[model samples]
Target: MLPYHDAALPVADRVTDLLGRMTPAEKAGLLCHAPVAVAPDGGLVDEPRTLLPTAPTTHAVRDLHLRCLTLMAPVAAGPLARWHNEVQALAARSMLGIPVLVSSDPRHSANENPLTSVPSGGCSRWPEPLGFGALGDADLVRDFARVIRAEYTAVGIRMALHPMADLASEPRWCRTAGTFGADPDVVGALAGAYVAGLQGDDLGPDAVASMVKHWPGAGPQAGGEDAHFASGKDQVYPAGRFDLHLSRFRPSLHAGVAAVMPYYGRPVGVDGLAGVGFAFDPKVVAGLLRRDEGYDGLVCTDFGVLTDATLADGTVWPARAWGVEHLDRVDRAALLLDAGVDQFGGEWCPEVVTDLVAAGRVAQGRVDESVRRVLTLLFRLGLFENPYVDEGNAVATVGRADFVAAGEAAQRRSMVLLANDGVLPLAEGIRLYVEGVDRATAERYTTVVDHPEDADVALVRLDAPYEPRQRLPEAFFHQGRLDLPDDRREHLCALAATVPTVVDLFLDRPAVIPELAGHAAALLADFGAADEAVLDVVFGRARPEGRLPFELPRSMAAVEAHPEDLPGGTRDPVFPLGHSVEALDWRPRTSEPQKG
Candidate 1:
C-alpha cells in the first residue's frame, strides 16, 4: 500500500507523506475554503452565474483539489445526497483520490437565514440553540445533537459549522439565535454536550465533526450589532470581561471539538489581543486559543477574510478587514497565516496564496503546517476509505417520522410563559380571534371569531422587535434596535382593551415591550416553534420547560444604557433571565407596575 494510503500508519505520518506529494497550488487550494456551486440538475458546474455565485464544485474538487465544501443552498434530501456523492466522486478523480469533506452552517432549525443557517428542507426541524438554552437541560441538547448528527450523516454532511459556543450576552446582536444563552455556565455545559453528541464520545466514520465557533467568544460586540457588516465590526469589552466570553469554549475543547472558527469582529479594549479581525490577530488565535487554551486543532475564519465580495445581484460587500484594512490583501493573508489560522473561508483564490509563497512573503513550511491539519481531519474521518453515501438510505432516514417527532417535542419544550392573567390552557369552547395564526389552526381549539370585539379571547402572534433594514441577504439577519414600533404597540394595547388578549411573541431577540406585557391577559415567548408545537404547549398536551435565555429590557432606553459585555445589565428588565412559569392557570402576583 502507498505510504499516504496506509491505514496502519499514524495520522501524522500519513499527513506528512501526503503533504510532500502535493504541489504549491494544491496546498494553496486547501487554504481557500470556497463555496461549491451545485447545479439545479444535480450536476456540478465550474463557474455559474447566480444570485449567490461562486466557482463550480467540479472545478474546486478536480482542478484545484479542494476537498472541503460548505453547502451553499438547501435542496431535497435525495437530490442533495446524490449531489454530495457526485462531488465526492469528482474529488476521488483528483490526483491523490482524496474525498471531499462536506460542511454546513446549522440547518436543523425553524429559521433559515440564507447567508447563515438554511431551513431544514427535508431535514428535521428543531428549536434554535437559544431555545435549547431556555430548556436548560444539557441532556436534551445532547439528544437534539444526536438527531441532527443522524440526519446530517445520512445526507453525506460530515462537518457542522456550528453549535456556536458564543453566549447571547448582547441580546440585540444579530446572531443571537445561533448562540446558547446569556449565561456562560449554561452555554458551556450545553456546548460540551452538543460537541459530544455530534462527534460522539468516540470519533470515527459515523461522526459529524462539530466546529465549535466564534473563538474568544462573540458575546461582547459594541451596540449589539453584528460583524457581518461594516456598521457592526467593532467588538468592545466595556466592562473588561473579555475572559468571560472565553469561558464557554473551555467545555468545547474538553469534548474534543474538531475545529474552532475565529469571528470576524475586531476586538477592541482587550488587553493582549490586537484590534485586527480575530483571524488576523495572533494574540487571540495563537496566544489565546492555541497557547493558553491548549488547542492544536483546525482554526478556520468566518468566511471572506481575504477579499471583498460582490453578490450576483451586483451588490458590493466590503472586506471585513476590521483594523487591518490598511494592509494590502497579500499582506493581510500573510498576517492570518502567521496568526495560526488554517483555512480561509469564502475566498477561492489559490493563485494569491501561491504567489504569496513564491514571493517569499509566506513560508512554504507554513503552508505545509495548514495542509497537515487539513489532511489529518480527512484521515481521522476515514474519508479516504469511503466517502459516498446511499441516496436511497438517505431518503429513508432523513426527516423520518421519528426524527421529526423528536424535533417537534423539542420545539414544544422550548416555549416560555412570561405573563398571565388567569386565561391559560386556553379554555376550550372560547370564541378566539387570532391575527397572525391561521384560522384553521385556531379552530381546532376554539370557535374562530372574525373580529376582536366579537371574541372572548384574542390571539396575537408577533415577531421579535427590530429596527427593520432591508439589504438582500443582510436584510434577513434582523439587527438594530430591539423595541416594538409605536404603531404596533398601540395596536397590541388596543386589542387588549377590546378583549382578553393572549400574545405569543417570537422571541428571537429580547424584545423591549413593557406596555404590551402589562396589557396582555397572557404572554408566551417562542423561539422558532411551529404553529402545532405552540398550540400543543397552550392546550396542556405538552409542557413548556423553557425559560428566558436573556433578559427583556424594560425599555429601549435601558437597552441602550446597559453594557453589551454584561448579561442582564438593564437598569430594569421586564422579564429576568431564567424566568419561566410552569403549565397552569397563572395571574400576575401584583397589579402595580414593578421592575422584574
Candidate 2:
C-alpha cells in the first residue's frame, strides 16, 4: 500500500497516505505549533520575531504541510485576510494542498492582554463570562457566543479557546469568571449552547470552532487553587469521585466541541507515566476521551505550559508537573505522541523534535502519526478553500452594536441580588453614593463622592485582593481559602464601621460574609463583572434572577467539613449550595431619599 503522504491523491487522502511515508521526525513536526512570521530576508525563521511578521513562504516548506497557525487577537480583517491568502497560497504550493488552521484565546472581552490580542482599533468589550452565568439565560450565552464567533471569523480566527467548562466551585480560581456556573447541568447546557452558537449549522471555514477546556474538571486544585504552581498543581479525582466534576465536560464533548485542551495540572496517579501533562495522558486523553466517551477530536496543550525552558546550565525542566520531568524535548515529543495528543498549541518546539530525530532518539514513524492528525483537522476546517479576507472587515466586524448589546445583556443577567432590606428599586432622580464604580458607570447613577457621609446611599464593590497579606504569599489568595490573620480582620472591621455600606463581593469561592456582615445595610454577591451592571441590580432596574450555583461556606471550618458530610460530600461549605435571597421592595427611610 502507498504511504499516507504520497502526492497523487486528494489533500486529505494524501495526508493519510503521507503519514505512513514519513519518519517519526517528520510527523512530530506537524504537532509543534508556532507563530507564523515572514522572515525579514524571506528565509524560514523558526524562532518568533519581534517585528510585524508576515506569513511563511508557501514554496519554502511545500513538502511539509503545516497544520495550524496560532495568531494574536485584535487582529484586523485585512491582516487576517492576508494571512489566509498566504496560508492558502502555501497550501496550493504543496502537492496535497492542505490549508492551515488559525486559532486564538478570548479576544472579544476587555481583558485582552499578553495571553490574548486586542486591537487598538475598536472591538466590542463584553463583560467576562462570569457575568453571563449570573444571568442564567442560555439564550444570552448563545448570543454572546454568536457575536464572538462573528467577530473571530471576520478576522480569520477560526477557533475560539473558550467557554471554559470548568465548574466555579473554587471562587479563587483566577479563571472562575470565564465559566458558566458550578452546577453540572448549568455548565454543561451553557457550554453546549456556546459551542452550537460558535459552530452554528454551518461548520464551514467562516464559522469558528470551539475548544472547550481544562478537561476532566479543573475547578478542584489541591487547595482550591490554580494548577500552575508545583505545590498546587496536582488534580485529585479520587475513585468514584470523577463523575461529580466530569459531568460538565461530557456534555461539551457530546455537543461536538472541535478540540479539548487538557490543563497543565498533573492528574492523580499520573506520576511516572510516559506523558506527564494530562494533555499527553493516554488514560485521560486517549482512553477516557477517545474510547469511553467516544470523542475523536483534536487535543491541544495549554500555551507555554508543557516543557520547561533551558536553564543557564543548559538543563531543560518541565514547565508544569503535569509536564514530563527530566526529559529532553525529543523525549517529551515521543511521550506526547505515544499518549495520543494531536498537536502542541502555543510555542514552536518542532526544532526540538527535529533535533531528536537527528540524534536518533526518536523514531521517524511517530512524528508522521501526529502530523497526519494535525493535517486532518486543518483540512476538515476548510482552510484551503477560503483563506483570506479584507482588512477593513476585521475592525468593522468586531464590537458591532449588536455584539455590545449582547454583552450588556449578559452583564445584566449575571448580577445576583444576595440580600435586600426592601431598600432597592431606587426612586428616579435620587442622589446615589458609589465607591469602586467605574467613572463612566457612576456617571449614570450619581455624582462621584469622595466620602459616603454626604451620599444618600452607600454602594461599595470590593474584590478579594489579588495582592497577598504581608505574612501570606500571593499564592494563598489564588487558593479559594484564605486564613486571614486576626489583625487583618480587625483592620477590615474598622474600615466597615465608617459607612452603612452596601457591600458586593465577587465570589470566586464562598467566603464568610458574616465577617463584615454586621457593618453593611445589605450584601450582594456575584461571580464577576464591572460595577455598572452590578448597580443596575442594586437599584432593581434589572431583577436579580441569579441563584447561588454552589454552596457558600459560613466559615473556613464549615468549608473543611467532609465532602460527604456536606450536602454534596464531607466538604460542607459555610453557605450551603443553592443559597440565594430575593431582592425586596425597600422604601427609603423618610429622611433619606432613594438613589437612581
lDDT of 2 by residue, 83-135 (tens): 55566566656554545666766765544233333332345666556556555
* Deviating ranges (above 4 Å) for candidate 2: 1-14, 17-27, 35-67, 72-98, 110-122, 238-240, 269-276, 310-318, 321-323, 355-365, 466-499, 560-574, 583-596
What is the per-residue lDDT of model 1 for residues 274-369, given as tens digits with 9 covering 90 to 100? 788998988888889999989999988888777877887788877788888888778888899999999988777778789989999889999888
Tell me model 1's lDDT, rounded to 2 decimals: 0.83
Backbone clashes in model 1, listed as residue pairs: 46-56
Q: Score candidate 2 by lDDT.
A: 0.60
Poorest 10 consecutive residues of model 2 by lDDT?
Answer: 561-570
| lDDT for residue 11 in candidate 1, whole number 0-100 | 83
Work out the TM-score per prediction. Answer: 0.96, 0.81
Q: Note the Cα lDDT for every prediction shown.
A: 0.83, 0.60
How far is each candidate from the true structure, as Cα RMSD in Å?
Answer: 4.0, 5.6
Q: Give the TM-score of candidate 2.
A: 0.81
On TM-score, the candidate that comes out on top is 1
